[model samples]
Target: MVELLAGLSENCVRLLDVAAAGVLLSDGRGVLRLVAASSERTRLLELFQLQRDEGPCLDCFRTGTPVLVPELAATADRWPAFCAAADGVGFRSVHAVPMRLQTTVLGTLGLFGSQVGSLDRSDLDLGQALAHVASVAVVNERAAADSATVNAQLQHALTSRVVLEQAKGVIAHVGDLTVEDAFRVMRRYARDHGRRLGEVAGDVVERRLAGRDLLEHARSVDLLPEE
Candidate 1:
């Protein structure tokens, strides 16, 4: 099953105008972890995005909708840090398509373009088709192993736990807190930062620039009211 999914992902990398491609599986709380990428560079890109908690892919996964960003330069303000970093690396555009089955969202398939221009209708259609295939492959794999509901829940839980543990470690190191306290700190940080908790957690795990600096910045920014 894993082999089949890997093949599907590889095919996606070849079939699109994207310079990089990745497949992520959702853990049911709006977090997608990288399952595969077309190449090492693509995987690194996905990891960077996940750790930063910003990017079209994260947006699509959260909204269960597709995101097409044609110009990273002109729209830098929309995702200030993300745009800067992505542009620095020569990725000027991005497209993210949600991988979903019915109401169940499996994850997202993300594409990166090194130039700026909205994807034409044909490209959009192809992106959507690829996303659908990836979603189906994930669902079918789970269903074949057991009842759909059980398998789905199990997968989601396992993925979420892995992400959570990694986030806890990040928070612990950065905030100088224990694991439990780190979780609390992260929850608080997410709420105050106006971001999803799991997304923040993923960022911490990935050690993105933002997440890596979050604790020091949090200290400087005054997280609580002064006495």
Candidate 2:
């Protein structure tokens, strides 16, 4: 991810002839955070964007679309804070490209130009291509992470199931009850105590919870008939 950000910043400088480049990514909480920049000045400016909450990057991220400002002076009324701050830092123009997948925007890539003029069609196309590639990488990475989490949860559920079955057998032998009754008692105890069934079952199997306790809880809850 770090390498990707660095490449993005460098490519923007080379291909767009911008004075500096920076990337800002959403924190998944509707706030843009600077992740990378081609130079120290650009990094500082990007950080300022977060503090002020007004910049081409923020606008692009919010709209899930590009924001091209050919002249900073021309946008001073629209983005006063951003334009003033950017002008103070020696930038005359800025362009922002959204890193997006379909309608979802993940971030923005910002370009700072020393002179004011719009990017040619070729430059705009290249900028979009870069943003597209970055978006795909981010989406794929997130999908892989989600898949791993699902796999881990499935494995834990399987282990819990095995432990629950063993607990049912133990309770049946200890309480002189059928396996079905034992399982019912365990489930009732867990529900009454606001604990996970797997946790209650593990305790029963380890003898941490006595068989008498399980029977008492079941009777208290009217989940099992008296023998």
lDDT assessment of candidate 2: 0.77
> How would you encode candidate 1's per-residue C-alpha lDDT over 6-48 as one tens digit per residue?
4555776577777767777765444667765665556667778
Model 1, residue pairs in steric clash: none
**Which one wins on lDDT?**
2
Which run of 10 residues does model 1 get worst, by summed lDDT? 218-227
TM-score of 1: 0.61
lDDT of 2 by residue, 66-121 (tens): 99999999989888988888898899999899987665667799989999999888
RMSD of 2: 21.2
Best candidate, TM-score: 2
Score each candidate by Cα lDDT. Answer: 0.69, 0.77
